[model samples]
Target: MASIQFKNVVKKYIQGKQSLQVIHGVNAEIADGEFIVIVGPSGCGKSTLLRMVAGLEEISGGEISIGSRVVNKLEPAERDIAMVFQNYALYPHMSVFDNMAYGLKIAKVPKDEIKARVDKAAGILELGQLLDRKPRQLSGGQRQRVAMGRAIVRQPQVFLFDEPLSNLDAKLRAQTRLEIQKLHRELGITSLFVTHDQVEAMTLAQRMIVMNAGNMEQFGTPEEVYSRPATTFVASFIGSPPMNLLKNAPGGKPGQLLGIRPEHLDIGTEGWSLVVDTVELLGAERLVHARVGDELVIIRTHEDQGAPAIGSTIRAKPREDRQHWYDASTGKRVGP
Candidate 1:
């Protein structure tokens, strides 16, 4: 296992006389055996940053060090890292065992050692019974496991996953997440995973990097980012229903915005008056979408609280300790 470091990392694309900067001076220290996730919306450069670590993308400036080596000039193979891509790139004709052992075979490892490594990986991934089956014969989840098994056989110092769970169904994605957690716990290899899904980042990351518009908005554990976001962007982007940023909140400061999570608001008799626009029942919870002045706000309520009628006027109080204050002009968190 090895630690990864990024020092003033930057990326830019040149088209004729114009240079478009995509990643702006990102710095992070990933400890040995830590699982980190880079998460953001599309066009946010999260994948670009992961590719830079994989040696697939060139760094326009700054240095990336893996372990004790500066790997800016090193080829992907020379960096001692294994990558599991989104698409399962297994050869169609090769059986699972052959696919897992192919890299070791090319490296001229002994046949006995190759078999041992493949066997071990197969057992860990629970692919021992399907080792002789071709990729076409396996389900999507099984094929993904084979891809992961191939990476495990290499035993690289670090692992890079590029949205590996995007292709799986919801149930399969949840199951595979558990499998991945187990894999990390057993191998204890340093891993960096890239995803646009906030749920995946929250669940899998020991620490997460939230990116926005070529800049890193925040890097911290899931609890920290969700509880106390650094900027309004982080506050709004990291949550499911998203944090509500109200410009005309009751008793609000003149130049500041008040932010609150949907769950942090309580239906009360004395507070901001809201006109209900819609109500959605999601399993055991209810979401009340309402308009407060011109701004829309969502309040999460338990099913036991009952749903309010559309067009009905109600009062919702923001939790005193849970409210977030941000600078209206800069959209940055302003107060403690």
Candidate 2:
């Protein structure tokens, strides 16, 4: 296992003669065996940062160190990191055993050691019986496991995953997530996973780096990022339905925006007047979309609490304890 340190890392692209710097000088520290996720929307620098760590992309400035060794100048193989890609890049004709063994074979590792590593990886990934089967014969999740097994046999200092579950279906994605968690617990390898999905980041990360438009937005545990967003972008991006930012609303100061999560809005008979626009029943709970003045807001209420009718006027207010304040001018969090 290895700890990764990023010191003011930057990336730039030369579009003709003009240089466009996408990743700013982003700094972060990831402890040994920590599963860190770099998360943001599309076009954000999350993948670029991960690629830099993997030595797949050139670092325009600053330094990246893995295990106290600066690896900015190292080759991908010399970095001692194994990356699992989004596409599950497996050889179509190769059996699962051969696929997992291919890397070790190329490295000229002893046949017995390769076999030992492959067998151990197969058992850990629950692909023991499927080792003889070719990639073409395996299911999507099975193929994904094969890809992971291939990486596992390497026994690298760090593990890098680039949206590895994006191709899986919803059910498979959830199941694969559990498998990944179990794998991490068993192997205890330092991992860096990149994803645009906020839910994945919140669930999987021990600590996550949130990015926005090439800027580092916030870096914290899920709870800290969710409850105490350092910036307005984090407050609005980390949640499911997302936190609401009410501009010029009641209880908000001038030049500041009021931030409250949908689940934090209490529905009652007396408070801000909201015209219910729609109600979405989601099994045990419901989401109430309502118009409060000109801005629309969503409130999550349990089914037992009852759903309000559409087009009905209701009263809802942001919970004082859950309120977050952001600077209107800079979109950064203002007060606790």
Candidate 3:
């Protein structure tokens, strides 16, 4: 395991004499054995940053270090890192055992040592029984595990996963997520995972980096980011239905944005009267969509609480302590 550091890393692409900057100065410290997720919307540079760490993309400015060594100019293989790509990247003609043993073979490791390592990784990944199967013979989740098995055998200082769960069905994605968490626990390897899924970021990450258009928005534990968003972008992005950021919101001063989470709002007798636009009954909870002034507000309620009729007026209030204030011009958080 190793600590990874990014010191004002930057990336730029030159196209027809135009230099388009994709990643701004991104800086963060990942501790040894920590799992960090880089999450953002598509085109937001999450994958770009991960690729830079893997040496798949070049750094345009600043430095990246693994452990105490500055790896800015080091080749990918020399950095001692293992990567699990989204597509599994398994060879169709090769069996699971051969695929996992390929890297060690290329390095010319002794035959006995290679078998021991492959067997160990396969055992850990529960692929021991499927060692002779080709890529086409395995299910999506099984193929993904084989890809992970390939990486585990390398025993690198760091592990890089690039949307490794995207191809799986929803049920399999959830199952594989739990398996990855277990793997991290048992092996305690430093891992950096990149994905566009906020749920994955919140669930899998010990800490996470939230980005937007190449700029780092916020980096923290899921609780901190969700509870106290540093900026409007994070406030709107991290939540399921998203938080309500109203311009000239009720009980807010002019030129300030009032923010409140859906669950932090409640139907009450005194407060803003919301004109109901729609209501969605989720399994255990209900989501009510209504308009306050000219802004839409979403309120989460227990299904047992029932729901108001569409087009009817419902009174609601935001929990006093849960209110978030933001600067209207900068869109950054401010004191209430």
Count clashes in each candidate, considering only residues at least 3 apart in sequence or on different chains.
0, 0, 0
lDDT of 2 at 79: 94
Q: For candidate 1, lDDT tens digit of each residue in 85-148?
A: 9999999989999999999999999999999999999998999999999999998899999999
| CA lDDT of each prediction against the hidden true structure | 0.95, 0.94, 0.94
Candidate 3: deviation at residue 229, Å?
A: 0.7
Question: How close is every model to the real structure, measured as TM-score?
Answer: 0.98, 0.98, 0.98
* Regions more than 4 Å wrong, model 1: none
Error of 3 at 226 (Å): 0.7
User: Which stretch of 10 consecutive residues in model 1 shows the poorest summed lDDT?
Assistant: 327-336
- Angstrom error of the Cα, residue 242, model 1: value is 0.6
Give the residue spans of candidate 3 off by over 4 A: none
Which pairs of residues collide in model 1?
A: none
